[model samples]
Target: MSDVAGTLPSTRPSFLRLPYLRWGLVAIIQLFLIAIPLADRFDVQRNGQVVPLELVPVDPRDLLRGDYVIINLAINSLSKDLSEGDKIAVGDKIFVGLQAGAGKAAQPVVVSVERDNAGDLAMSGTVRSLTENEIRVDYGIDAFFLPEGEGRIIERLDTSRVLLEIAVTEDGRSLPLTLLVDGKAFQSDAAF
Candidate 1:
């Protein structure tokens, strides 16, 4: 009986017995989760079409959050007619068609509730407000972070000359890529 007690089979599951294997699986899963979004952003950056939008600069400073510019694009407000008679309500997802202007910058040409109707160079935005004459949309790329102490230089510049260059995928996903002030690239301190 004493020998049998000493040799009793262990009750713990096989996976539980190997702690390192279990932790390694957890670490792999965590790494996989982190890689997904990073890969998506990389894909957009690599494959998306570059579009430059004129900026409607607003006061861009947050005392607590460090230096960053609040980006307001000229396309934020569109003529109601651009909707092509589609009733756009607040909170509705809409696509705005764009046409290249004489300059490199693109201009909004039309708006539609259906992505297919928005043409090739369209951008996706959420309708923020609707009025009798105009529609306002939020494109989510509304903030550009600057290096420490650099916001002051941007704040003093004539914001009308600022342009935000964004890469927009066919599916309407957009990423802000560069800032141009007076037709020249504004060097950003952001690592990526």
Candidate 2:
């Protein structure tokens, strides 16, 4: 306590000079090792990540490319048998499971071909709803216009959801006939 050469009174700021229960266990281990992977790479701009689906098609042209809702999700479709140059493009992230035997109408297939770290694999079955897709299955309006930007800004049209009319079955198989909304069939237990 007698060394005031350069007026050194520095007693805080070297990792908070530690020792307060080891700086609260180093701040909860730096919040799960560096703020949880930087909050999991911005987690798709977060806004309540929902994942319910069952709207095979009914968006004739939800205002086309602007009102957007061109989806495909039999639990998250991926039935590529391949033929038209074995498609899977549009930022491929192919890996949806179920098809080996598809016993109970099995659905949800696309077991592995990885590509979308976030590209969205043909809009990875867009989401943002929590109920009614026959009974829960989502990712609506493409994750609510992906962090909110396009999809015609959604223009507030989540009616009650059930707007499907999917089809990509040239072999990339994502075909789901229809399920209408402003046209009828409010839900007769239609699984596709």
Clashes of each: 0, 26
lDDT of 2 by residue, 34-126 (tens): 767445333432322212334443233433333334555455433334211233343433434333221122345333343232122222332
| Model 1 lDDT per residue over 128-169, tens place | 998899999999988888777877787888867788888889
| RMSD to true structure for each model, in Å | 2.9, 15.4
TM-score of 2: 0.26
Q: How does each model score on TM-score?
A: 0.85, 0.26
lDDT of 2: 0.36
lDDT of each: 0.84, 0.36
Candidate 1's C-alpha runs over 4 A off are: 1-16, 59-65, 188-192
